[model samples]
Target: MALRTRAVLVHRRTELDELLDRHATRGQAEFFLRTRGRTLADVEARHEAATSARSAVAASVPSDWALAEVERTDLDRFLFAPEDVVLVVGQDGLVANVAKYLDRQLVVGVDPEPGTNLGVLVRHDVGDVAEIIGSLAAPRAGAGEGPFSAVRCDELTMVSARLDDGQELRAVNELFLGHPSHQSARYVLGADGGAERQSSSGLIVSTGTGATGWCASIAHDRGGRRLPGPTDRALAWFVREAWPSPVTGVTMTEGVLGRGGELVVTAQSDRLVVFGDGMEADRLEVSWGQEVRVGVAERRLRLL
Candidate 1:
């Protein structure tokens, strides 16, 4: 059978949706917010705008294309197809949330509320989806043009961490390896030709795409370190608050993992967490004496 283009509309639960679910009714939700010195009208207005944007993007999908709507909570259960053209319709973080679950599918980010977000990832508006879909569906190799020349795309690098037991995780932003609580985490960070035992909060292994997020902030606070670009085949890692002591050293705190380089963390604490893009529920657990490897993944988010 010929592959059909599936337009997956990815969204999250709006604040109003959450309030209604928690408070059971709009009046009750309004009353609850009012008690907290916040007005429900503002929430409703934002909700209406988001709902309208989602509806507009949904209507923009090609009529012949198969349509699938997946909430942020249901992404783990949703089966994505190879020919799928994703329409990420939400905040920029939504793009990172969906990237790990995808492969080479062309992702068109539809920013619902413009000017509010940094526009680092979701670069298109609701009006641009129909045209992006048309461009994606149109023929390639026009005259001297190459594949996908009709559509502009960025091949963004991602970070992947693998444990010894065959479990693996990928993230477009960064991979956080830490203790469940905010307590001290014990581990040995191995990267850039050396290894050292350190006791600290945890480690954040990020990519060029993630550089603009958490890693960038860390870089700025630490007097700024160069990070890889979005298309660069590299990954950067930072050891948070590494303490200098008799047994632990802080010199191996932060570094970049070039091409084939990797970050190997040997667990010394009871249990260390490894999650990507803030999805802690769905994550890898590393116990004492176990090893986890973090590096640039072979899969890249082909974002449009």
Candidate 2:
């Protein structure tokens, strides 16, 4: 039997949804914001735009394709197949959230409010979704000139952290290894085989796709260190606020990691966290005596 093509629409809850979840009622939510010198109009407008964009995407999906909808919060529970084509309809962060769950799946990012959101990753406007999907669904004819050529995508690199316990996690942009409370975290960090013990706020392992976000900020603060481009296969690692003390050192603070190379970190704290793309709530906890190896992931994001 032939494999079925599934279309997965990944989305995150809107700001208004969060406010209402907290306040129970729209009026109450407005009142709570008003007390803080804020207005509900902005949040409501964003919610409306998100709703309109999602509805348009739903209508555009063809009937023949098997459809599945997964929220960002529920991504861990969703099972994605290799034949799936994922569509992220929201901010650029949503694309990052969904990328790790996919393997060889094509992703289409739709900006809900293009005028306000900078959407560096979510580059396609809502109107461009249909054409993009059509191109993806069409059969490829030749090399670069085909109607369905995969060249219409921006192939982005990603990072993966595998624990010694056999559990693994992938990041579209970067992976943060640090204390869950952002306190000083103690650990031994190593690249390839050389190692050192260090105390720092945390360690950031970033991919070329993540060079623009947290990694870029760290580089900017450190006299503007050079960073990799979005498609570069090499990864960059930075130790945030590495404190030099009697037992801690900052010698292995920052560097680029290419293929066949790896960054190893051993846990020294009672509890450490490894989260990706700024989603702290979704993370992996590393306790004492555990080791994590971070490197370029085998999978890549094919952004159309």
Best by TM-score: 1
lDDT by candidate, in order shown: 0.87, 0.85
* Candidate 1 local lDDT, 148-231, one digit each (tens): 434568999999999999999999999999998957898888887789999998998989889988899999988899989989
List residue ranges in candidate 1 displaced over 4 A. Answer: 140-151
lDDT of 2 by residue, 1-304 (tens): 4356678888899989999999999999999999999899988998999989888877777777788888999998999986677889988888998888877677888888866554667877788778876766566454342222344578788999999999888999999999999999999998866899999999998988788888999988878877778788889899999999999998889999998689999999999999999888888899997999999888888887
Query: Candidate 1: deviation at residue 191, Å?
Result: 1.5
Superposed Cα deviation of residue 125, candidate 1 (Å): 1.0
C-alpha TM-score for every candidate: 0.93, 0.92
Best by lDDT: 1
Q: For all the candidates, what are their Cα RMSDs to the real structure?
A: 2.5, 2.7
Query: What's the lDDT for residue 297 in model 2?
Result: 89
Check candidate 2 and list the clashing pairs.
none
Error of 2 at 210 (Å): 1.2
